[model samples]
Target chain A: MSWRSELQALRDDGFDVLDWLSATEEDDEVVVTACLVRSEDPGSFRLVRSPAPVESVVDMFPSAQWHERETAEMFGVTFEGLNAAPLLLPPDSPAPLRKAQPLPARLSQWPGEVDPAKPRRRQDPPGTPWR
Target chain B: MAMNPRASLELIAENCTSCMLCIRACPVWCLELDAHLEVDESSGRRRSSLALDRFSIDYGTCMMCGLCVDICPFEALEWSSELPPTQFEWRSE
Candidate 1:
């Protein structure tokens, strides 16, 4: 069965979404997890994970709108029913949290006692094409 | 007045080994340094030392939190309450 139906069934079973977040995974994919807490027992909670490009459960859970929008913008993921609006970040800014994204600094060498042989962050000039 | 040793920042520039531990500890990025290594002709050995070209702390932004003094591995930095009044020959603004 689809995750939308599963989330709805859980909601009917007195589960409420406490929070939601996303993390990058292997193979250039992302995972979105929802923290659901049972209404009868706030101490008991469950983490539900689903791969990116998954269907949005915002229609069944209105609180998922911000979460879905944030995940979509950060990981370049798509949600089937989500509106075309930016959230959390300015429109057109790079997805900084993604593992593939380049860091902001350009240190010529490591400072202090750090091992010099260890690879440092890439120092691409601004406006260079991103990988 | 007896100065409190733990309330102000001090630096013994000659004792610095330039390890840059204090630079990394600065939360506001107020510390800066430039260094170079060269062979000492008399000693016949290579030695590293800071150039003092850009080793300046922007007092405007420094919160005086003392993280830089505490993190100096070479014991070059210290805290003292004997700091003199701010004296400037000119003003930028």
Candidate 2:
């Protein structure tokens, strides 16, 4: 079944609490997860999806708005119909959590590059060859 | 009962083999280590050993989790009860 339909079904089944929503950037795509809970029950329901234009659950769960925004900002996941303002980082900042993202600190001179034994030979930082 | 309050992190340079286990284990990347290989042939046979040049921990970024001390294979890192001054520098003595 479609994720939207599944969410709607859960909501209809009295899953009133939207515990949390977040995303992780995998090697190829971003994975978005939403946790739902029912006050009557002790456990929670987790919904995981991998979509380029992920549907926004804000309409179903208002608390998902901020979590979706943060996930979007960090992993560059675009949630459809969710207009998010700049949260922790500036609007133009690169997606820091993406695997392809190059850390600015590693691009600069890293202290670990210094080798006391060999002055001529240099070692690249952890994340090198940004390409 | 006596409570030992955590303060500054101490580095026992002599015991440290520069294995870099602490640096790798640091979640915040606050620890930095630099070492070079030194070879000596004074005892008829050549012996190579890792000589630690510099080792530093950025207390500003350190959360004092004591993971580095616990992860040190050589027991090079330890916790000192003496509180560090506000402007104190973390240098390997």
Candidate 3:
């Protein structure tokens, strides 16, 4: 079933509260998850989707406006009908959370990379083996 | 009176191995550590050890979460009851 239809079905089944919405990068796509809860129940359900140009559920869940904006800006996920206004970052800034985005801190000289006693060989920065 | 008040973070320099664990574990990236390799050949056998050069914590950015104190495997970081000065200045010695 389509994510939109599933969300509609969930809304029909008393899952009225939108707990939170978040997204994570998985491989080349962004996996968006929305936590939904029933007001009378003690449990919550997660709705996951990875479709490109994910359909906006703002009409159903008004709280998704900011989440979609942040996920769109950070992970470069496109949300259809999202206001495209710059939220947290400047309009000219690149998507910072994307895997391909080069970290400015990584490019600069990390103090951990230098071993004063062993000047001949450079040491890798701790927790940054990818560099 | 509180038995264990978290007032200051003290570094036991003698026990530190310059492992960089505290710096990596810090959530705010407020900790900075500098070290160098020291080679010893007293017994006609060469051995290398890490010698700490500088370690500084930016209290302005640090949230006092104690993650660094708990993650220090060498017991280098500890909490003290002595409160930090109101107008504290951080300098790396």
Candidate 4:
């Protein structure tokens, strides 16, 4: 069945769109998830996952427009049928949230293993690696 | 290490290199650092370093996760047993 068919089935079964978002995994794969809340039980939610290059469901659910646009901007995923325009980022800006994107050199201390008592200053402000 | 369990955060501003690891590790994102690069031409070797103008952590939103204390490469942040004053004149700014 098509992705739209799955969403329509959920809608027919009395489910409402709660939230939609996408994330880039460590392996460089982008995954989009949508939460559908049961109308009778607001506390219960069903999560739906779609890998990158999936079809857009904005036609079935208008609320998914912004979410699809955001996923496209961050992960470079094309949401077919949605407006192909930058949502939260500028047009000239690169994909800053992609897993493979280059990061600032200063953020190399992510592991927290470096002792704080040492002077780790580098010759360059944020380009050269600290000794 | 022997440390006061009830102490708040202690910061050694001069030792900080403004690497921003602590800022990213912070769960609440309460720590803020305003820094810029400057060149030191006085010495034979011209070296550029970051000049931190303002470094403030909002205790109002801080959860004291201690990630900043552990991740600082320069031992610039520490935990002190003496907490900040409880009473303060509330300002709108």
User: On a 0 to 100 scale, what is the lDDT of residue A107 in model 3?
Assistant: 68
Q: A32-119, model 4: which lDDT tens digit per residue? A: 6778888688888777776677788877788888888887888788877778688778897877777556656435443233322234
| lDDT for residue B36 in candidate 1, whole number 0-100 | 45
TM-score of each: 0.58, 0.77, 0.74, 0.54
TM-score of chain A of each: 0.73, 0.79, 0.81, 0.72
lDDT of 2 by residue, B1-93 (tens): 454667888888899887766776675667788777889999989998888877777777788899988988888888888765433333444
Instruction: Kindly indicate the candidate among 1 and 4 with the higher TM-score.
Output: 1
Model 2's chain B yields a TM-score of 0.83
- Clashes within 3 Å, all models in order: 0, 0, 0, 3
How well is each residue in A16-126 modelled by candidate 1, as lDDT tens digits? Answer: 755565646666567767787887888887777777768887777788888778778887888898894887788898777676675554223323323112225333332
lDDT by residue for model 3 (A10-118), tens: 8889897777776877777778777788888848665656555678888998987888888888877787887867789988789898777866756656644544555
Q: Give model 1's TM-score for chain A to 2 decimal places.
A: 0.73
TM-score, candidate 4, is: 0.54
Q: List pairs with backbone clashes in candidate 4.
A: A116-B75, B7-B80, B7-B81
Q: Tens-digit lDDT track for model 2 on A1-131?
A: 66667777888887878887887766687788777788688486656465555788888888989998998888887888899776999869988988787765555455545455566866555545672
Candidate 2: misplaced stretches above 4 Å? Answer: A114-131, B1-7, B24-27, B34-50, B65-67, B84-93
Colliding residue pairs in candidate 2? none
Q: Which order, best to worst by TM-score? A: 2, 3, 1, 4
**Better model by lDDT, 3 or 4?**
3
Off by over 4 Å in 3: A126-130, B1-7, B19-29, B34-53, B63-73, B81-93
Q: Which candidate ranks first by TM-score, i.e. highest?
A: 2
Candidate that scores best on DockQ: 2
Q: Score the docking of each candidate (DockQ).
A: 0.14, 0.41, 0.37, 0.07
